[model samples]
Each structure stands twice: as C-alpha cells, then as structure tokens.
Target: MPIVHHRKPSLLSFPMWLGTRVLLRPTLSLWPLNKAGMAGLFLIDRAFAAGPKPSGVVRERMTLDGRPVELIMPSGPSRRDSETAILYLHGGAFVVCGLGSHRSMASRLSKETGLPVFSLEYRQLPQFGVGTSVADAVGAYRELVGERGYRRVIVAGDSAGGFLAGKVVEAAAQEGLPRPVAFVGISPMLDLDVGTNPDRSSRSDAYIPQNKVRELTPLLDRGPVPLQGTRRIRELADDAFPPTVVITAEGELLEPDAIALVETLDDADVDAVAHSYSWQVHAFPVLTARHPETLHAIEVTAAFIAQAIREAKDADDRKDQRAG
Candidate 1:
C-alpha cells in the first residue's frame, strides 16, 4: 500500500473537529438506524441541499433507465475529455444527500477534470439496501459506457458512495462490462466488517461507531455478493480493477478501512495510492468549500483520473496500430 502522509492541522480543521467530534459523533452514534430516522435525515439534508448551489456549471436533471441523475458540465465553452466521462456517486451513508446535495462536488469535478459528471441519485436504505443501490449504480454506469458511448468511464464517490463505487467496479466485471479506467474513493468504507475488530486505528472517531457498524452491516446489504463464495467487499477487487486513489482522514473510523483496501488492491497487483491528512473529518473532500485540504484532494483525484485515462487511451491506440 502506498500511503502519503500530509501534516499541519490547518485552522480550517477546527470547525470540522468541533462538528465531527462535538456534534456529529454523538448524534450519529445515538440516532435510530431505522426508516424514520433515515427520513428525518433526508428531510434535513433536502433542505440544506435546496439552498444555494455552485456557480459556473450547468446542471441538468434527467433519468437514465428510470434512475434520476444530474449531468454537470462547465458553464462556458469547454472541451470534453473526448469520449470519457465520470459517473459520480454521492456520499450520504446510502440514505441522505441527493443530486442537489452533492451538486457542488460534482460540478467541481466537472470543472477540474474537463469531463461531464453524471451524479446518480441511487436508492438507499430503509427501503433499498446496499445491494439495490449497487444495482442502480451499475445500471447507470452501463447506460453511460454502453449505449451512452463513453469510451472510458471513471466511477468516483465519497463515504458510502465510495463503497458503492467499489461495488460498481466489482459488479461491472462480473457482468462483463468494460472495466472503468479508474476508481476514486474518499473515506470509503470498503468492508462492512470494518466495524468489528479492536485493531482498527481510530474506531472511536467521528460519525461511525465501531460497534454500531458491525451490528448494522448485515442490514446495510444482505443481498448476495456478486462473486461466488465471497461475502465481503474487499475480496472483490482483482487485476480487472483500474488504478485507484483513496483519500482518508487519519484517526477517523474509515482510515484503517482505507489502508486495508489499498493493501488489498496492491496485493491484487492493482495500482493504488492513499492520501491521508492527520486533522480532518471523514469524507471531508466532499465539502467543496474554501477548505485547502479538500481542494488538494480533488486536485489529486482529477490528476489521477486524467493520467489513468491517458494510459488507457494509449494502450488502446497501441493495440489498434498492431491490429491494423
């Protein structure tokens, strides 16, 4: 696993520190993990998302195979990445946060990568578990890369969406779909079993309870795994997966999970890198505000995706030349 450590606890972290540990931690740890609870959060998130959105991006609401999605692109005359696009899945623990909620990050990604970003509003828990959400995501990805005619697609997400991103990479291969050129996960929870195990570096950190995750893992996704005899997500990655970049907040609940996932990808001979900041909250990259570290993470993610696509394109060109 290639781990890059970043130091300096910026003053920006103080608010996140207070928000995560002081506010979010207790609330998340005690909240009822039921439909009503999810609904309440959804309402709250909906209001927040309904507020001011990002500027300089054209956001269009549309549906792909009956799934609601938002297509975000740069406002002015811009050049596309040329047959390459991003299928972005937003993080919200598979419950709250929708297109409006995640529009900022998606729009920023569009601006940064010079590619259209399709932010899918997948089904979530209380009605649909992780399996159903994964199904929706995979279907959207297929539509984009198959009929939609994107030659190279990258699946990227944050938090729970990151988990879905991983699942999309795994399921795409099982369905014989073209492999994504790259995968980007920020504070992704790759393994539901992450909550178990006392060895987790920072199990006590914000927004995720070590014990709660273990108990809630089965409820999150009880459907059959795409791979036979393999129940955990970490077992899904193989050589078929493209290069991956994961950003984790050190001392947060998902840091160890990110480390373990990078290790898994590395062991599978997949190029993987993890960037960690010591003083940040889980999934902070999605903030998309004036945060320095968040901006840095997004920059790194875009660079990785661009480089991966270039390599993939080069390989394709080489093969075509040989065939001709």
Candidate 2:
C-alpha cells in the first residue's frame, strides 16, 4: 500500500499527546524566549529524556571528519555484513539532540535491522547552516560506502534528520556517489516554506508550534531563509531515487510534509510509501518504548529495509551473470 493509515488510538500515547498539547507546544509558542532560552529548554529536556540501553549491543565512539559519531553494533549474528550498514542522522530541528540524545533509537535500529548504525552528530544552526549539515552527511556516506566499501547502505532519520536523510539521497545521486539502497524518513520536516504560509493545515498540531518554526528558520540556514523547499525533491529523476518509506502521525505538525514528499516521489515514479497513524505525536516511533504501534512501525521499517537489500543484491547478481 502506498499510503497506510492506522487510526487506532493507543492509550499509551495519550500522555504524550496531552503533554505535547499542554506543555511543549505552549512553551515553544512563546516567541519571546530568545534562541538561548529555546536552546536551554531543549538541553533541559535532553537531560531528562533517558532511553533504554539495551544489552548485547556495542557502542563505539568515532570521529568522521572531526564530527562525533556513535556506531552501534549488535553482538549476535545479524543480517549485516561488511557490505551492508545503516547511517542514521538524529533529529533536533538542526539545533538540539546528539549522539547521546538519540543513542536509544540507534541502538534499537541496530537491533532491529541487524546492521551496524552510524549515528552522525552533524553540525547544526547558530553554529553551522543547512549546507554544513548536508555536507557532513554526504561526507560520512562517502566514507562509509566509498572508503569502507559498504554496498548496501540505508539512510534513516527522524524529524529534521529525516529531511536531511532525503536530501542526502538527492545529493548523493547528484554527486554520482554510491546510492543508498533505501531510505526511511520518520516524520520529516520536509517543507521549510510551510512556516511562511499562515494558513498551514497543521496550525493546531499538538506538538509543534508553527509560528515558532517560522521564527527559527532564519537561525537554521545562513544563505536564505527557508533554505530548501518541499518540491526540491521533485527535481530528482526517478532513477535517482531508491525505495523510500515515510512514517507520520495523524495530528502532527509535519503530516502535510510527509504527504507532499510522498506525492512528489510518486510523481517522479519512485517507489515510495507512507504510513500514517492516529493519536501519535511527532517522531512517535522513537519517542516511546513498548508502544504497540511503535513496535509495529519498527517491524515494518525493518521489513522494508530487508526487502530493499534483497532486491539490490539480486540486481547485482543479475549484472554479474550477464557480464559472465
């Protein structure tokens, strides 16, 4: 299915839904709080948000072009090999979050995908702009695939990271680098222009403050406000894209982003699918543990990755046979 909707509301998600509506949304809406204050709030939230440290996984610290990256690997036999891996970019609106903040999701993804995951601590706003972040991501991917010789790399991310992931694929294709086998964008912030339009469909989104997002745009990129548009992906040809999957929540602020991206990919004749769930907040897949829907989403993502890898390998095998 191109667009799957799971409208079953989960009681487990109620607290998060309520908290977003009453606490986080209002706090972010307060534009009076300067960048420092907003950043301070994010740091405070990161301090308290502890994710599970699952056992039997190895966490290694490494530096990619002077940027910090955490590599997560499962101890047991996984579906991974020297030629296959995952590169994960963490989401923080191009400001907050890092290896520490997103380690839980990386660990979980490693466990689920049976592949080592390189969680990039890319540069963010106020210090670096959108160009730097994209450069960092593309550089890391080159290191992994070109230098490390990983043949089946999957790029995955959530929120801002999701947007970065999609952009990485586009850039990689344009640069004639080794293409990723697939990509997964979980509630990506695709439309930088959404903040410009006052009549956004998700004005009442429970978690994200639309006005605050607009205010933060100038801080994210140096060259131009709204550095990227949602339709930029449309410029990529069908052959430039790999199988892609986008997961979004029903009432989340960026739901329209997910829809628009999928439609764009479809227009390019790229194999794209989207899953929308009811009563789930933004980045719900990584924000919660043991939520039935969260687990289901992970399973679905894992399956998609696995299928993409298989198809890639099969295509390679066919090419080899033809050459022989």
Candidate 3:
C-alpha cells in the first residue's frame, strides 16, 4: 500500500514508543517487516519518481471508480499482447498502506506475468471504511473489462488486500459482471469474529496480536463510511465464491482463513488451490529478492499465476474451436 517516509527517529514519545517496541520486537521478527511492526507500517513508502524509462514500457495516470489510479503497460516488440491484466488490491488492515508501498510487488508481478498491472489506491479506514474500498476495487475491474476491452483479468491481494479481493469478486459475481478467471489471496483475513477461529487466536501468531480483531471492529464499524452491517454477510457468503487460490504461511495466525477459503472454493465447484509455505511468515513474498524465502515465494507466485493464465487461455481456445 501507500508508504510514507520520515527521517526523524522520534516520531512520538521515546519512552512509550520504546516500551511498545520492546514488547513487540520479538514478535516483529516473525513478520517480514522488523522496524515498523504494524504501527510504523506506512512510514516506509516514498513516492515513486519516474527515472530512466524502459524502452517499451508505458506508464500513465488514469481514474477508476472516481478515484485516481495507475496503469503500468509493458513495452517491447517481443512482449505478447496481453489478453489478461491484473487489478491488484493492497492490504494494510483497511487503514494503513497503499499503492506506494505495494508498487515494488506490483512491478515484480507485472514482469513475471508479462501483463500490465493496475494497482488501485482505494479509500481506507477512519475515512472511507471497508465498503468503500471494496466498491472501488470492484469498480476498477468492471471499468477495466467493460470500457477498456480486457476480456480476462485476475483479482489478487495479500493479507488485508486478500480479504478485499474476495469481497470484490463476490460483488462481481452477484452483479453478473464477468467473474475474474481466478482469485489469489495471500494470508487473508476473513471472519470478523476474533474468536471464531482458534488458529488465528494462537499465541504463536507472534506478529499480529490476538486482539487485532477487537481493535479492527470499531474501526470497521463506527469509522467514516463504515461497513454498515454487511461485514458478516460478506464473511459468510464468500466461501462459495469463485475459481481461487489462497496462499499463507502455515505458521501465520491467519491459516484458518486459508483452510476455510479452500473449503469454500470446493463448495462452489471452483477450480482452486491453496499453498502454505511451511515455515514462512506473513507477506514473505514481498521482501528483497536476495532472501531465499523471498525468491522462492516469488517463483511460486509466478508459477501459479502463469498456470492460471495458461488454463484460462486454453478454455478460451476450446471455446473458439467449437465456435469455429
């Protein structure tokens, strides 16, 4: 998501901050980000400045769902004209994070999939709330397909972004817009009841506190542009969703969401897959590529997306052959 950067060391009180850090540091190592924990999560993002441009790639500004958005187009004669694109949602607990912090991840996926990626900067909590974010996310997809002539696109996100991906796809299915070819969720947060899933409540979850659900509830409820009682409905019905993939670390607190998602996909008869990295932490896929875990996660992500792309192409080809 959006990243805000600052050079100042003491953004707030040193004693209280140090106390918080001391308490949270052990848990921080369990997550991909060590310095920020969750509090400073939005600090790392600095705006992306246009630099020496790539020869064939095109970058432009556009508006989606009334919100300003970005589209990254690949250039090169050898690059295949993409029949598919990705509309990405970034996760920051519906509060922090945005397109800036997520740009690197988006760019890597674009390169790997050889397809343009659209990363939406949707409304966030304490301002726009969950419903607005989901609306904008779904809106981006519909606009892309209906107005922009993209036939097939995938909806993907990580952590909280993954939750939004599921919500948007569900909305699309209900609205009868052509459903995305596949859905990929990384360490998703589903089922608002903090106690509903024990896997998510375990002490070993390390990074995310056990009370995160309680903390997030008021934010999603009374916050600006709140969910307005639809949160439970979304959580319950999202199981019978669509062709999907749910990826998470087995060690993560959210593993149950992944399992529950698999069960939901099965109920819907959607072609689906769930892959859990054995010893991985949350959002391990977005780290520097030099780390072995990061490299492996990226490779796995690329392979999964490529497979989905190929399968989607095959289905279209078969349909064309029959029509011909």
* TM-scores of the candidates in the order shown: 0.92, 0.91, 0.77
Candidate 3: 10-residue stretch with minimal lDDT: 1-10
Candidate 1: pairs in clash: none
- Expressed as tens digits, the lDDT of each residue in 41-88 for candidate 2 is 466336634645667799889976667888899986655577899999
Task: Give the true-structure RMSD of model 2.
Answer: 2.7
Candidate 1 per-residue lDDT, tens place, 1-324, comes to 388898886888877766878887777778887768777777765775778978888888898768999998888987776689899988877777878777888888888888989999998766777777888888899898888888899999888888778878877787898889999998887765666666774554756666667656767764442323233556776677789999988888878777777787888888889999877888887764669998898899889888999899999899899999
lDDT by residue (1-324, candidate 3, tens digit) is 011111232222234334433565355435432223444555544433332233445666788878767677665554654578888888767767776676667776776677888988888755556777777887898898888888888888887788777777767767888778777776777655543445455454535665655555555543344453334323533444556666666556777666766766566565666666554456656533344544555666667778877877898899999999
> By descending TM-score, how would the candidates be arranged?
1, 2, 3
Please list the residue runs of candidate 3 whose C-alpha ends up more than 4 Å from where it truly belongs after superposition.
1-42, 47-58, 195-199, 222-240, 267-269, 320-324
Candidate that scores best on TM-score: 1
Q: Which candidate, 1 or 2, would have the higher TM-score against the true structure?
A: 1
CA lDDT, every prediction?
0.80, 0.78, 0.64
For lDDT, the strongest prediction is 1
User: How well does candidate 1 score on lDDT at residue 122?
Assistant: 90
